[model samples]
Target: MWRTIGGMLGTDLCPNNIWQYFSWCYSFLPDGEIFYTFGLAALCWAAWNCRNRTTFEFKKMRSPFDVIYVACGFITYWAGLLMGEDREAMERGAKMLRGNAANMMRICAAPGGVN
Candidate 1:
C-alpha cells in the first residue's frame, strides 16, 4: 500500500496523513514561494536593465534583510521539522514559515517601500 511505502521513506517530509494534507494546504502551499522567488528575480532584473538613477541606485537600495530573514527562518524551521517526532510539530513549523514568508514578502513589496 501507499502508506507502507510512505513509512519506508523513513522521514515525514511528504505529509503522509490526512492531517498533514490539511496542514500542508494551509501552510506549505508551494504557490506563494514560487511567486515570491520569481517576483524578486524580476524586480532585480528590471532594476538592472533600467537606466533610471532612482531605480538603480545602490546607496538608496533596499537591503534584502527581510527576504533573508524569511529564507533563513524557513530553512531553520523546516530543518527542525524534519527532526521532529510527530506531525503536529512539523505542521506548526510549516505554518510558522508560511506566515513569516508572507509577512516578509509584504515588507519587501510595500509601496514607497521598506529597507
Candidate 2:
C-alpha cells in the first residue's frame, strides 16, 4: 500500500531521476535518496491512516483547529527539510514553527553552540 502510493506520488511529483531533486535540495541529509524515500513512505502511511478515519463531506464551516493543525504539520515538514541534518538547525526550526522565532533564531544563529 505504501509502495503504491509512493510510486504514484513519485511519478507525479518527481518523475525520471527523482534522486536528483533530493540530492540537490537536501544536501544536509547524509543520504538524500533514503530520506526522500522514507519521507514519502511516511506520507503514504499518514494518508492511509486518514483514509481509515472518518471522512468529511462538503464542509460547511471549516474548523480553525483543523486548519491550525494542518498548518503546523506543513510548517514542521518544510522546516525540517530546510534545516538539513543539523540537529541544532532542526531544533531551532521546530521552535520557530511553534511561534518561538526569537528564541529559535537566537539558538540557530548562536556562534559556539545551541542551548
Candidate 3:
C-alpha cells in the first residue's frame, strides 16, 4: 500500500493523496490502528458528538474533561473487540488518558487553577 506498482502511467506522481495518507500511515502498523490510531478517531468522534450535543441538544459541557471522558469510554469499549496484548495495551492507554484527564479536571476545579 505504500507504493503503487510501475502500473501508474497516467497518474501524477505524489507522496499520497491526503485521504490515502492516513490509510497508508496506519496500514500494517505493529501497533495496529484499532488501538492508537483508532483511539484518535474515537476521540474525534466523541468531540464531534459532544459539539452536536451542546449546539443542538442545548447540553452544557461543564468541564473539558467531558470530551476526554467520552473518548476514553469509546476507546475502552472498542478495546473489548481485541485480544491478548493489544487489548491490554489499549486498556492501559485508555486508563492513562482517563487518569490524566481526571487530574487536569481536578486542577481546573481547584481555586485559581482555571477560573
Candidate 4:
C-alpha cells in the first residue's frame, strides 16, 4: 500500500524497511512531518477498516489501491479538525490524494493497464 502511495506521488519508494519508509515520508512531503502524520493516520485507519471487513465479513478488495481511495475519504473528513492554514493544507492534500488514487484506479481497470 505504501508503494502504491509512492506511485501516486510519482516516486519509487524502495524502502528496505518500515523505518526507511517513515523517514522518507517525513522528509519528502511538502509539510514534511505534518503531511506525513496526516497521511499515515488516514492510511492506517483505512487499512484497519479493510482488515476488519476482510476478516469478519469475508470480503476482499479487488485492488490494493482501494485503501488509498478510502484513506482519501478519511483524511478529507478529518481535515475539518484542523484550523486556518492547516485545514487548507489538509484539504489540498486530500484532494490530491483522492485524484491520484482515482486516476490509478482507472488505469488499473483499463485493459492491459499497469498493475
Top model number, lDDT: 4
Instruction: Evaluate all candidate structures by whole-model CA lDDT and list the values in order.
Output: 0.41, 0.40, 0.64, 0.78
Give the number of the best model, judged by TM-score: 4
Q: In model 4, where do residues sit more than 4 Å from their true spots?
A: 14-16, 110-115
lDDT per residue (tens digit) for residues 22-97 in model 2: 6532653454343455444444444444444435543432322233233335435654555446534444433433
Off by over 4 Å in 3: 1-34, 112-115
Look at candidate 1 and tell me the lDDT of residue 38. Answer: 30
Q: Which digits, one per residue and each the tens of the lDDT, describe model 1 over residues 1-115? A: 2221123223335555556644544454443432333323433443443325345563442434333334334444444434434434444444554455455556657586456
Clash totals, every prediction: 0, 0, 0, 0
Clash-forming residue pairs, model 4 = none
Report the CA-based lDDT of candidate 1 relative to the real structure. 0.41
Off by over 4 Å in 2: 1-31, 55-115
Q: What is the per-residue lDDT of model 4 for residues 1-115, given as tens digits with 9 covering 90 to 100?
A: 6666777568886566668867777656645566676777788899999889889999998788778878988888988888889888888877877777777777778677568
Candidate 3 Cα deviation (angstroms), residue 52: 0.8
TM-score of model number 4? 0.80
Model 1, runs deviating above 4 Å? 1-85, 112-115
lDDT of 3: 0.64
Could you give candidate 3's per-residue lDDT for residues 1-115 as a string of tens digits?
Answer: 1112101112233334545545543553345555546655776788899999999999899876788788888988988988999888878877867776766566657577565
TM-score of each: 0.26, 0.29, 0.66, 0.80
Q: Name the candidate, 2 or 4, with the larger lDDT value.
A: 4
